[model samples]
Target: ESTGRPLVILDLALTRDVDETVRALPGVVHLDLPGVRDAVPDAEVRQVDAARAIIDAEADDFERTLAGRSMDSLITALRSHIGRVVMEEIERLRPLQSRLPASAVPSVDGRADARVVAGGGVIRANGSSGAIAVSVAAPETTSEAAAKVSSEAADEPVITLAQAERALHHLAARLLHQPTVMARRAGQEGREDAYRQALELVLGPDSVGGTHD
Candidate 1:
């Protein structure tokens, strides 16, 4: 989460308008960078990529340097900076993160992440859990049943994004198993009886009876 460069510590010794400079660069905030620390009012640029080279070299000088008095005289290591960065990113992702697939959905412990799918009309993601379990009785030749379901769902009230996601998962699973079930039952001896049984498997006795003419 702390993958982005959040801190922008300006060298008051070499640059002026630290805040303005930071604002010029996208996503650069003075909040991450501590108060400025400078040895000289302004140091002229002697070469190119000097800052990059120093960062690449990874040589630390804080141990050797003692406390100083300047507008940039802040200490105690920028420990909280990284944390602040991560929190900011998490906040950015919270809104749509729940809609993401289970693989990409991270376990957001504190925030209002969809960590669990509550039963019935509610939706949630089981805290860091695998795919949601869906069941269907749309046996042998689900084309008619699936088509009917789709048609009816189209007329229903607008569902929340979470509900739509759950519906998608269920529809995908139902379609996947449709062929397998049809193949197994295709070779059955009785034609009319088999068709009736399959229809019953799909809609159950109550549904079939309710639809009778």
Candidate 2:
């Protein structure tokens, strides 16, 4: 009676019988053993569909999480590689800057930068943000000024901005070449753990996962 518009009563045993007058009530359904057996398959199908939908949703969420982790790991690795390259180059050039005459070293008031944007496009060595952006705050002379100094002061040891850019580019390229290729393959192959492990191994454990923006 409480089953909404139509009350359904299932009697799997034929021992107890339903009253004739009670069965006569409007919007009342009485199903015997045969009728109940006939409904089982349809009910089972509906339940199976619901369970499958839930499983699919959970699987999709898990996959997306793994993908996100892999991407984060890759970015962290790239940034770490870029930062190290920038620092090494800066240190290497510092001695040259100090030894040269003040006029030979042109001062610049900005940090060196590199970035990686969406789509994980080709890695850029320039100190700018793209698919991944890496900026380290170090006040230094511009590469262009250093280049001019090289030409004007031939006797002195000097490095230009172009050289620095190239150096950064080359170093980054070397470090990223294998990782980039493998990372893409990992994503395609659903090997997230392997990719993360590789990145951590190559870039250090600190590069496990990090956010740029």
Candidate 3:
């Protein structure tokens, strides 16, 4: 009574074992052998169906989560690949900056930083450190740039950057499509080990985010 929990009594004896007054008590349930036996099958069927539904839902959620993680890891690896390519290309261009035609190079006050403005953003490559920095334009700046682009000729650097970004994005999607498909198939087939092994072989052992559960 203090705990406010219901009390359940199962009387299996052939004769009356519990006092008749017990059934009248608050929060008390008294079940005789015949009553208990008769309710078992229907109660069990209901419970089993509920349990199966929950398990199926959980399994579907787990598969989706796993597939999302696989895609995320692949995207991370792709970004790293793009960064490496950018760094290498920037380094290669460092020596040829002076020899490059004036029409090819964007005007800058200093040779130490090369900046490209495209699609309402700026990408800067540091000549000395070989580091890259990217920044998105503010809303006002983007609007002004858009107005300027409409009124005047679009900058060559902007066009080039947009083209490069589009090409890279397309290539990355194509490159990663197969791996993503394989990951989904592996998760559905319960062959997660094969997914990890194939990714390790392709992206290297250190590339696949973290250990699996």
Among all candidates shown, the one with the greatest TM-score: 3
Give the alpha carbon lDDT tens digit for every residue of 86-156 in model 2.
77765654454444455644443343332211111112233333133334333434454444454543332
lDDT against true structure, model 3: 0.59
For model 1, name the residue pairs that clash.
35-72, 36-72, 37-72, 115-125, 116-124, 116-125, 116-126, 117-124, 117-125
- Report backbone clashes per prediction: 9, 14, 0
Q: Which candidate is the best by lDDT?
A: 3
Query: Model 3, 23-120: lDDT tens per residue?
Result: 99999899997776678898797998999999999998987777556555544654566556656654543443333334433444433344544344
lDDT of predicted model 2? 0.55
Evaluation by TM-score, superior candidate among 1 and 3: 3
Native RMSD of candidate 1 (Å)? 30.4
| TM-score against truth, every candidate | 0.22, 0.36, 0.38
After superposition on all C-alphas, the RMSD of every candidate to the true structure, in Å, is 30.4, 11.9, 13.5
Ranking by lDDT: 3, 2, 1
Question: Which stretches in model 2 have alpha-carbon errors above 4 Å?
Answer: 1-73, 102-158, 209-213
Stretches > 4 Å off in candidate 1: 1-121, 131-163, 166-172, 175-180, 187-192, 205-213
lDDT of each: 0.37, 0.55, 0.59
